[model samples]
Target: MIPQRKLSLLSNRLARKGGRRVPEAVLERDYCLSWFLVGLSKTPLIDILAFKGGTAIKKCYIPDYRFSEDLDFTLRESVPFEKIQAYLALAFENVEKDSGIKIRISRFDQNVLGLTDLPDSGL
Candidate 1:
C-alpha cells in the first residue's frame, strides 16, 4: 500500500505541474479498464468517489474543465493493491503501444488510481 504522506506529496507535485483536469476520454478509459481489472479479481464496485475535477463526472454531470491531463478514481473498498497496480500497468502499456504516447499508471490503493503522461524523450 502507498503511504498517505507519499500520496499527498505526489498529489501536490501534480497539482503544481498544472496538470489538466481529467478529460472525458480518460475517464471512460479508466472506468472500462477498472471494471475489467476488478472483474478479473472478482471484486465488486460498491461506489466511486472522484475528488477535485471528478465531482461532476461522479454526479453524472458534465465537467467544466477542458484539457484535463490527469484522472483520479476512488474505489469503494480495498483489494490487493499490487494486483490493481499490475493491471493498470498492463493497461497503460497497451494504450501507449496503440497510441504511440507514453502513459503511466500509479496506484495508492485499490481506492485510488492515477493516470498521467510520460515525458517525451524525443526519440
Candidate 2:
C-alpha cells in the first residue's frame, strides 16, 4: 500500500513543477485504477479483458492527456455474466488485500460494474 504521506508529497512536487496542474484527487484516482489493473492482471480474466476508454488512452498512449475518473474494459471473448462477476469480485478482493484500497461494486448491470472506493480509506 502507498502511504498517504508519500502520495501527498508527490502531488505537491508535481503541482510545483507542472503547467497542466494535476490535482491530488486525480492522482489518487489514477493510483486506485492502477492497483485495480494489477489485481485484474493477476486473474485469468486478463486474457479476455481489454482496457479501453479515456483512462486507457491516458495511461498507455498519452501521459499528458486529460485525467479520467473511471475504468472501462471490453471483453474479447463471449463470457458468461456470472463468471465475469466472479472474476471482478476476486479482483476487488485482491486490491483490498494487496493495497489496502477497499473497492465495492456500487452498481451492476449486464454491461457495467460501477466501483467506488470506500469513504473511510482517506485516500
In terms of lDDT, the best-performing candidate is 2
Tens-digit per-residue lDDT, 1-123, candidate 2 = 466777788778877776555767778889989899889988889999889999999888997677899888888887888999999999999998898999888877455443443346657
Q: After superposition, how far is residue 110 of candidate 2 from its true place, in Å?
A: 4.3
Which residue pairs of candidate 2 clash? none
Model 1 C-alpha lDDT per residue in residues 1-78, reported as the tens digit of each score: 234555556556645665543333445454444343333233222233223455335333553443334444555445
What are the runs in model 1 whose C-alpha is more than 4 Å off?
1-52, 55-60, 63-69, 105-123
Q: Which 10 consecutive residues of model 2 have the lowest summed lDDT?
A: 109-118
Error of 2 at 2 (Å): 5.5
lDDT against the true structure, per candidate, is 0.45, 0.83
TM-score of every candidate relative to the true structure: 0.36, 0.77
